[model samples]
Target: MRKSDEAGTRPDVVRIWIALGLVIILIIAAAMMLVEADTQRDQQEQVASVISKLSTVRARLEGAINGNLLAITGLIVEISMNPEITQEEFSRYASVILAQKTEIRHVSAARNLVISHIYPLAGNKKALGLDYRQVKKQADAALRARDIGGIFVAGPINLGQGGRGFVARTPIYEFSESGVANQGRFWGLLSVVIDVDKLYGVAGLTSSNQTIEIAIRGQDSSGSDGAVFFGRPALFDSDRALLDVSLPHGSWQLAAA
Candidate 1:
């Protein structure tokens, strides 16, 4: 009888040990699962934070681009309204624009699509006789009705001059037959060549411990080369590729990584 009772007690002891081992294993597994979940959540939050920062930076840059375009356009329109502006008058205005060294690159005027005035930088002897209308896209843009009152951003082209730059043109209109018309017919195009390097620097992008990239692309539906205006890569081996985006007219898309 005693032996039987001892045997029964031994079996109960073994069963208790097995049950305890299973409970410990379950606890460890639960802890590991909780830790993994927390880590994943943290990573997702970090990615979201980076995306938000990029969006804010892009918005600020777009505002700057628009503001600069408007400033140049306004200056051109003001000069055009003065019907009797002489070469001396233009030189004086050019000097003023050049004085704004940080922002203004160069101010120029074209009469009947011929280079008339190029500011600050001299030796424009060759530029004088060149017909701007030869650049088909620009000539077409100059004729657009919307170009009269305001300015339009033009060209990612090599301006056939010393530097590669873009143009901001505001059309000059002759006063209409009706006295009430504030603007005249399209007589000429006033443009400014923006220094690409200077424009990018103003965007306020900088590298960090992690890799970073910045780029600007235009929105075009026709699937033409969406112009990439600028980019800065943080890594030496980073691929500099244009990112596609849907952007509104008169607006540009900025992307960062």
Candidate 2:
């Protein structure tokens, strides 16, 4: 009888241990799952924060570009209205616009794709007669703009005026003749160079205080594919805010990370 009782007690003890072990295992598994869930939530929040910051950058970038573009529009209008528009005379009137929008580093008028007149020529005097046809880098964009017979944006290249920046060139056409055939005769170009470095300041995209990175690429007037003008061009490869920047006769790809 005593052996039987001892045997039963042993079995009971073993069962109790097994039950405790199972409870311990379950607790550990639950804790691990909770930890994983918390980690995932944190990661999601981080992603959200990054996206929000990128959105802000995108908006600011668009505003800066659009605002400056308005200045360019004014230049085109001024030149379009008067074919004989001289740089000096135009500068006297357009200087105020430049002062208002400091992002425009310089405005130049090209006669037959040659730099003829530039506003505030004190620093850019060297570009006075530089022909786009002679400038290898600028020549392609120049010819394209002329062939397109419209405004095109190119560069962030070493400008003839010195330093690196973007040039928005619009081929001027002469409608001097009365006939419809001569109404669209090609004239010259009115271009504005936006300083690449200074553009960050104006666009408020100078710092990377957010998770998402921002970049810009120059594309042909028809599409969003070209060399990077600013930031990591690879950002465009990943998920990003593809902002379109309208130029005179072209556009740019603004990638916000």
Candidate 3:
């Protein structure tokens, strides 16, 4: 009878051990699911933060560009009214504008497709007498600005003066003797060189950002159809936040991850 009881107790103990093993397995699976859920939540929050930063940068960049462009309008008006503006007069006026807006590298005027007047001619003397028709890269945009009778931005391209910058070009039509702008008489092109690094720094897009990686494409404001001008090209292919930078003639695509 005692031997029979021991056999029965052995089976009961085996059953209890099996049940404990199953419970342990379930607990581990649940813990893993919770960890995965937490990880996903964290990733979503991180992505949200990056997107917010990108939006803020976009606004700042646009504001900086538009502000400087608005300032250029006054100079354009002056040039339109006086198509015979001399280098000395142009330099003096440009000096005042530059003094107010430090981000502007230089201001130039092209009369009959020939670059004639450039302000702060110290470093930019090389660009003087540059013929827009001769330069293939810039010729198209310059012509487009004239034909469209509006402002067209080009580059982040290699400049004759040195370095790379965005050139905002607007067709300057001469004012009639009656003090009215005559679209029929296209006097020249007015261009302003924006310091790329300074502009980016003002927009908080310099290399100082450790958490977010940013890339800008759409050279010449061609939007996604254009090449990458800032940051890595691969960034656009990745799962990144994208925004369109509204420019004068076209748009730039901004990506952040």
Each prediction's Cα lDDT score? 0.59, 0.72, 0.88
**Candidate 3 — which residues are off by over 4 angstroms?**
1-36, 176-184, 207-210
> Which candidate achieves the best TM-score against the true structure?
3
Model 3: per-residue Cα lDDT over 5-123, one tens digit each:
99999999999999999999999999999999999999889878988989998999899999989988888888887889999999989998899888899999999989999988998
Runs of candidate 1 with Cα error greater than 4 angstroms are: 1-40, 136-150, 159-163, 175-183, 206-211, 219-225, 232-248
Give the lowest summed-lDDT range of ten residues in model 3.
175-184
Ranking by TM-score: 3, 2, 1
Q: What is the C-alpha RMSD of each candidate to the true structure, in Å?
A: 5.7, 4.2, 3.5
Give the true-structure RMSD of model 2.
Answer: 4.2
Better of 2 and 3 by lDDT: 3
Q: Which residue pairs show collisions in model 2?
A: 151-249, 172-187, 172-188, 173-187, 174-185
Error of 2 at 155 (Å): 2.9
Query: TM-score of each candidate?
Result: 0.66, 0.75, 0.83
Candidate 1 clashes between residue pairs 3 or more apart in a chain or in different chains: 173-184, 174-184, 174-185, 175-184
